[model samples]
Target: MALTDAPVAAKSAKRLRRQPLWIIYGFVFPAMAMALVFDYYPALSGLYLSMTNTMEVGIQSQFVGFSNYVQLFTSSIFLNSLWHMLVLAVVGMTIGTVVPLLVAEMIFHLMNGRWRYVYRLTFLIKMLVPGMVVVEVWGYILSVGGLLDKICHFLGLPGGSTGWLVDQHTALPAIMFIGFPWVAGVGILIYYAGLVAIDPEILDAAAVDGSGGLHRVLNVDVPLVLGQVKLIVILSAIGGFQGYFAQFLLTQGGPGWSTMVPGYYMYQSAFVNGDMGLASAVGVFLFVLIFSITLMNMKYLRSSQDYAGQR
Candidate 1:
């Protein structure tokens, strides 16, 4: 009986070995197909289009070969808009990354219960609020006759009655402030989840060793949550590069284009100016920038452990 079972066991083991390969292909194929359809094809098409002079109304195109990219550098408006995007990326990343992590860390120290629930719910609600609604709400709040202006006037600040979003000097920063809370609220939730996953014993040990409050957080909690911080930073950077909706709704990239971002520029190129070729170039540039940043982030932040080790 044992000798007969040996052959059956061998066959079963062979099938098991084959099963995983089939499963791997099965799982990978759908994702690969989706990427080819939605991501890769569009990207390749855009690269091809960038070398041509394509207009919205025309079905015909003339291959111009690098002229669109060359023209980008020569156009002062395009160059200035690109520069503005860089600045916005830096500023947005700073506010979105730093503030959320700090808030998460503070929230973590609070005894987990109703307070945590309430705070988390509040942030989630803020996230659910529409971007346009938030922008318009803040627009009213920052207007010349808005609540902030009245408060500033009461405090006797300079330009107390001024419209913050209409002033070129403050417009970009004001728009940034409006957009930031939405992004930061999401980041806070991510970090909060990360904090919850941390081993409680480690924190307890730190407290027992007389490391309390900020010292304990800076030394122990922060290091342990470095992975989460890295995630927040990379995601925030990506969001910064892609940010435009609030600025579009609120200032319309106005106050002398101070709030202009790459996304807005791409939109204008594609629709308003009807320069599909230039828009494709801008799309390609954004794709490359985002891809490079993501690669750099993964290289620096991702751990070296294999699947078994992580488990």
Candidate 2:
């Protein structure tokens, strides 16, 4: 009887230990359900919609089976828009990732904690400003006789006579320069936090070994905070890939499609041309491209870390 009772008691304790896990899973289930309903369901719907022709007036959406995608790839305007998006994404990714990391390094090296806090707070405040407001402000800055143009005029430069946003040569470049310096609040803050979390003893040891500032940053700092770098790169890629709001507001995909991007073209297809199927196809393409690159990036990072034995 005592032997049987001992086994029963052990089983009871094991079951008790699992109760909290069950409760945790119960707590998480609802949020997962909501995400599936609101986020993933729409994505799946869009995927389905991409394969069908949803353009018929007062009729059921007919199954088109990849025809929309064929139309998209064949269209010069669509391909051009994709090229523009690719350029913007590449340029934005580089600038956005590098500038914030460099700024964060600067802030981290500040001996005065108060100044670091002040700078961080300032960037955070900038983040709170509405996106539309930022765009409008930049529009004014790029407009003729506005701040940039006036500065250019003071320097006696051409192309300042017209709004930079209206010039075929400068329009895309103007869109690219919207957030000058690109010290995005989230990027700076996240990188700064990652840097701050690094063990100061390691940095001190590096310094003791006669490592200069750049050397320390390259060998010690960057490796330690590479996870943060990866995070920022992925985020910047996503943002730049879908970035068309500035074009929508400032350029309207003009001066003559110079600023056209896939996102803007998708808007044109859906709203301007009433071609929901093509728009859905574009959405699917962007999603796939982003997802594939993100996966590849993560895989590369993981393999590199493994090879270098990063902690």
Candidate 3:
């Protein structure tokens, strides 16, 4: 009787395991389907399209091999656009990462809840404004005879009436500044949440050890929140590289392509010039660059965490 019951029990256990396996499959399939429909399918289609010469109005496409990529490499406009993207990536990362982290840290040290709530709400309002509206508003602010110019004039500064966006030398930086606050607000919120997650007891202990303010922040707060910083930095770098809307709406990649970025150039290639192959190649390049940077950041962050653990 015992031997017979053992086999029956084994069969029941097998059936139990199979039930949860099917449940997991049922839960995972919808997400997989959505990924294929939205992401994977488009990426695969783009890859195929990038290898062919597809005309704007024609139904026929001819295989062009890697000619599109070769042409992009030889194009001075594309090269310059790529350079502008690099500069934007560096500048945006600085503005998006550092400014927000500093602001969050300062706010974290403040004892007043009302002031913190006010600042948080202010940033939230700014973030809630439509991107197009922000771009348009800033375009006016940067224009000659606009509020910024009037303020500068009031201060008695030379070139106060100059339109920053209309100059090749300052066009990209002006657009970057317009987008900076939008990107920085997200980072600030992330850092603020991270700061709140820190243990109050740990902070008290640091204070008892005679570490005050700057020393405590540098030693205790920074290490604890390093993970959030890493996430913000990686996100900022990606946003910087892909920044397009403000530049497109405000400068139209101009004052001689000074405000041009990879996304803007890609749009011009595909839509304006009807060069879908080259545009797809540009897209692929951006994907690779962003992927590489993200991986490097992850590795460095993991290493830092390991070192902190040792200490």
State which candidate has the highest lDDT.
Answer: 2
Residue-level lDDT tens digits of model 1 in 185-257? 7778777877787788988898899999889878987776676677777887888787788667777778787
* Backbone clashes, candidate 3: 0
lDDT of all predictions, in order shown? Answer: 0.77, 0.85, 0.80
Question: Which ranges in model 3 have alpha carbons more than 4 Å from their true place?
Answer: 1-30, 112-118, 160-162, 179-184
Q: Least accurate stretch of 10 residues (summed lDDT) in model 2?
A: 1-10
Q: Model 1 shows how many backbone clashes?
A: 0
Q: Put down candidate 3 lDDT per residue, 1-311, tens digits, no spaces.
A: 11012345555666554466778989999999999999999898788777888857476888999888898889888899889988888887777777887788888888689888778777777777787897898898989887767877889876534598998887877777675445337777888888887889998999899998778878998888887778878988898888788766888789888888889988888888898888888888888889899899879778877876696
Off by over 4 Å in 1: 1-35, 160-162, 179-184, 303-311
**Worst 10 contiguous positions by lDDT, candidate 3:** 1-10
Which TM-score value belongs to model 1? 0.83
| Per-prediction TM-score | 0.83, 0.86, 0.84
Pick by lDDT: 2 or 3, better one: 2
Clashes of each: 0, 0, 0
Q: What is the lDDT of candidate 2?
A: 0.85
Model 2 spans > 4 angstroms off: 1-33, 56-58, 304-311
- Tens digit of per-residue lDDT, candidate 2, span 1-311: 11112345555666554467878889999999999999999899899889988874566888999999999999988899888898898898888788988999998999799999999898889888999999999999999888998887778876467789988888888888898978866889878878887788988899899985788888988888787787778888999898789987899899988888999999988888888899999999999999997898778767756855644
